[model samples]
Target chain A: MRINRRRYLTQKVAKILIWMAALSTMGVMALIVLQVLSEGIPVLSPRFFLESPRSMGREGGIFSTIIGTIALTVVAIVVATPLGVGTAIFLGEYTREGRISRVIRFGIGCLAGVPSIIFGLFGFVFFVIYLNMGWSILSGGLALAAMILPTIICTAEEALKAIPYSFREVSYSLGGTKWETVTRAILPNAMPGIFTGIILGVCRSIEETAVVILTAGSSLIIPTSLFSPVRTMSVHFYILAREGISMEMAYGTGAALILLVLFVNIVANWRLNRYIRKRA
Target chain B: MSAIPSSPLKAEVKKLNFYYNLVQALNDVNLPIAEKRITALIGPSGCGKTTYLRCFNRMHDLYPGNRYEGEIILYPDQLNIISPKVDPIEVRMRISMVFQKPNPFPKTVFENVAYGLRVRGEARRNLLEEKVEKALKQAALWEEVKDRIHDLAFNLSGGQQQRLCIARALATNPEILLFDEPTSALDPTATSKIEELIMQLKKEVTIIIVTHNMQQAARVSDYTAFMYLGEIIEFDKTDKVFTHPSIRLTEEYITGRFG
Candidate 1:
């Protein structure tokens, strides 16, 4: 009876400690969100989103930066999705676990751990200087694509692995070729997971400032073409805060960025849940 | 060797050997699959019964380093199904399989049944509907699923899902249907239902089954091959093999003495 009471007391203490840790984590997130939203919400007027900045960002709005962010992100996603997904398929399906596959996986693991600032440096050198792309959306977008490739490949590969091996066998026994099996039996089932990866890539692209600033120049004008230089919202926020240009505008941009990321995550999770429910 | 069946031959496996990398999984196995008849392969666990059954459709080719020796000759054409020259896809086109566990695609019941047809590039809406309906009916699942044909296959009961897999296999009108412990994951009622379906299906296609259940081999198979240690120790009529002693190992396994 004494031992049982001691065990119960220990369990209570452990539970309270864990509960405190979780509550503190939540507390930090709530504080950050509340601080940003309180300062930035009032600045989000219709004109702020519709008009271009003027007088070196001291007046007017940040319409051009929004367009720039969209264009750069579009270029990044369009280039990255196929390449990442294809690489994942090739790695997961075409090759057996051998020395070559192991080496390739090791390379991807190393790439995933590289800092984004290194990506910025590489983009500045290879894309801007060597390729003569100059400071443009194409350069920055390609750099962002490379930054997100490892994330997409790793997630997509995991999703592919989650499918039962029997599904492949069933497809093969039904006379379906490897390509047919992947497209019909495998990809359709893995779509939700793959979409989640893409969503993650989008979030990374939106939040990224270093790579965009170095490769895609901070042009205040909205981009007219893929080759045109433009400023993304995050880059705008970074410059505003760093140069002491406009603290209010920086907070406003930070709020928009947070809201966008949260929205994407929520929508992606909801869709994934629906898909799992339907399959179940 | 036992006397060959009097029925016309659908395929012949002659001195067949199979290897997985350096490991030999099937040794010098030979069997005759009679046309439109059921042949059952019975064995203790790890005796390579499923390995032999997979040879009929070149399933081992999907992986690296697995190799096949000798011939699995399909009758009429006399084509060696296991030859390196024959594409695995071509071999697979003529054969379909039902797995040990029910493996319905994460699709609607209609789509699950229609997958094989779609893979074969059959695109006419009316023809797809007809074939899907016919195959589902042939598998004895059409009546229960007719209304909810559009519903996801995962919603079906375990027995119904297995039947749906059978229907999916049947949709392509394969020349040979391979069953790799198709009913092992099911209950007694489902197992009996699957046995009945297999018996009925032999009128249209040749069948090669790998079963763990001795009673199942006795009930549904026209011919039975008892395998031990990756070798076929006895092959004969199911009744004769079950009732009479051909080899000590066969008798021992049949009488529940030892595997």
Candidate 2:
């Protein structure tokens, strides 16, 4: 068969455009990686990763900030996962295509679109002040949970919906109840998708500065309890850079942040692939 | 296990009428499914054979807006399966179904077979193992899958997956089994295996099969019901239905004159 010259030329142009679009994204990522490496590599040292901040983050390391970052993220995820997964199941399975479900879905969509700064204000007022938690990790975690709930719920619901209706029919015909079918078949199948949502939420928590600064105080001291005020890595990096206290420390924190992101992406992709392979 | 069929009628259908919203799918379906025997419902596509088969276990209850006006009275218990008072879950437990396409759960073979028992609160490892093995054997898939029972159900071929589904249904020890065009997707070899298994399975449980293949019904079924446009046109012994049908429509259908 002979190809039409005009159509072939059009197809060639479209292919080139697609290639250009894809390369542009890759080029931007490479540029950012190069810029961060040049600025951050010099300041990143053993002491920067080990010792507590001293003299307003100019003299010592950011070990306390690292611990605080992980602690708050862990708390956020622990609280959010169950709430998000339950909400997803309720929305996707029990009550699909109805007035209440539509309203809940709309609410979730709105929540996801809200700006990070507004979430910070909400955490500061509702969690820190109103709840009297006094700028602690608990308050920050609670706020972060609320912020990431929409992402988790949406992804989890998508996962649940992806499962074929035939599976559910088989379960029912086997004398399984709704709860039994969900726990045994639906949840296990949807775990990888749910984990992807959690990984994204974790990534968000890691990079977040405003919410942490407002709800979790930027203290140099390492936190002893959930009540104690502490600074996350993002907030510490933000404060150092904003106050012109230490550019070196800020770059080092940025480098660490980049590495954490790389680690998370690698792990998430690996875990997801493993699960998909197992399912197949 | 009752080797001898105590009564001719295992389940008596009286004034069975089914509707999908305003559209009536089955109209006044009345038939007696024999005890410990295979009763095949044969008809063309959209002839209400599959729809009538679904009503046996109340499979239509899964979706909303599906209405049933009937009494499917199970013998001995005499429970009206379609009644508002009786739970559909309990009815399904006593009567399980195997679908057209193989739909094995995304779990191990053992887990898939053990699921029915586990759902009923059978947690003891020995009991589950015993029942799972028994069901697999009954489905004639034990030798093929015994060594690899721990493997995922999807790892099996299409026919094996269908057998696994059958094993899963059989594991629950349902008194009645409904096979809805079960061999429609199978190759001749797999189809023959399943047909033989169905005949053997009738000794343990009453079997109601819906098939388009006239030869399959003739081979396996004790009785045959020919349906057309949501109504039974003929119901008689398999030999009589194939050799000398009472209705012209049934004779035309059986002789390949037209659907």
Candidate 3:
């Protein structure tokens, strides 16, 4: 009876600890959301969103910043999606488990761990100095693309791996060539997972600040072309907050970024789930 | 027991042995698969009947760590299907396979049947539609799925999925079809439906089925080969194999003495 009581007490204690842990994690995120809302909600207005900033961002809006963010993300996706997905397919399908595949996998793993600032420095040197691109959207996009490539490749490979081997067997048994099998059976089924990776890359590129600041020259002027200097919302926010330009606008930018990510994640996750269900 | 009519040769497997690296999976296997007939390969689990069936299409070549010896000679030219000179893809085109579990490509029902046709250079839309319809009808699934042809293959029930896989195999009109325990994962009604389909299908394509169910072997097959420990113990008409097995081991297995 005593032992049973002791066991029950231990179980209750463990349950309480689990609840506390979950609540604490939620509490921290809630605190961040609340903080951002408190600091930024009053600053949100049509003018704040639609008008260009003036007097070194002490007034006006982030219209140019929004355009810059969109352009940079588009360029990043254009650069990264094909390259990352191709590498993933090659790793997952085209090659056998050997020294070369192992080395490539190890390199990707290391790349994933590398600091984003290092990518910033590399972009600054390779694009700004060597190539003389000089702080353009193209330079920033390329650096961000490099930053997200490892993650996309890793996720895409895992998604490809998740497909049942039986799919390939069925394709081959029906006389599908390796290429036919990939396109018809393996790749089609792997689409949702691949999309998830691409979406993740987009989110990463959208939020990245250091790479944007270093490679994409900070300009208050709206970018006219890929070669022109641009500034992302994240870089704008960082400058506004750290340089004491405008805390109100900075917090507003933070709120917008958070909402954008949340909206994207919810929509993408729903679509992905639906697609998987339809296939399954 | 029903008498099996005499049929011409379809495939001739001679002294074929298979290895997965150092371990031998098949040993000196010799069997003749007759044309337009259902030949059932019956044995306990791990008896290598599925392994032998896969050899007909050279499905063994897909993965590494697998090795083959001797020859599987198909009809007409009696070409050794296992030779490196003969493309494995071409071999699979002539000889198709259906696995134990139903594996329908995650596409529309129409597309699933059309996949085999598409792979072999059938690109004309009207022709593809007609062939897909014919194959689905041949699989005995058309009546049930005809209305929703564009629905995803995954929407079908398990039995329907298995039949769709059969239709996928039949789409290219292969000379031979290898079924690796095709109905093992199905219910009794679905199993009977597939068995009936197999019997009906023998009027065209030659059938080689690997089965663990003795009753299934008895019902659908014209010829039954009992395998044990990687070697075929008896190969004879289904009636003879079941009613009067020559080998004690086969008799023992059929009589429920041991697997």
| Highest lDDT against the true fold, candidate | 1
lDDT per residue (tens digit) for residues A1-280 in model 2 = 2568888998999999999999999999989887877798888889889999999999788899999999899999999999999999998778858899999999999999998888889999998999899889899888888889999999999999998898888888888899998998789998988999999899998888888888988887989999888899899889989999999888888888888888989988997998888877
Evaluated on chain B only, what is the TM-score of candidate 3? 0.97
The collision pairs in model 2 are: none
* Sort order, DockQ high to low: 1, 2, 3
Give the CAPRI rating of model 1: high
TM-score of each: 0.96, 0.97, 0.96
Each model's lDDT comes to 0.92, 0.90, 0.91
Error of 1 at B76 (Å): 1.5
Residue ranges of candidate 3 with Cα displaced over 4 Å: A277-280, B1-6
For candidate 1, the TM-score is 0.96
Residues B1-259 of candidate 3: C-alpha lDDT, one tens digit per residue: 1233477888888889999889999999888888999899998889998888888888888888898899899998889998878999999999999999988887899999999998888999999999999999999999999999999988898999999999999999999999998988999899899999999999999999999899989999989999999999999999999999988999999988888
* Candidate 1: tens digits of C-alpha lDDT, residues A78-148: 99999999989999998888898899899889989999988888999999999999999999999999999
DockQ, Cα level, model 1:
0.81
Model 2 scores what on Cα lDDT?
Answer: 0.90
Lowest summed-lDDT stretch of 10 residues in model 1 chain A? A53-62
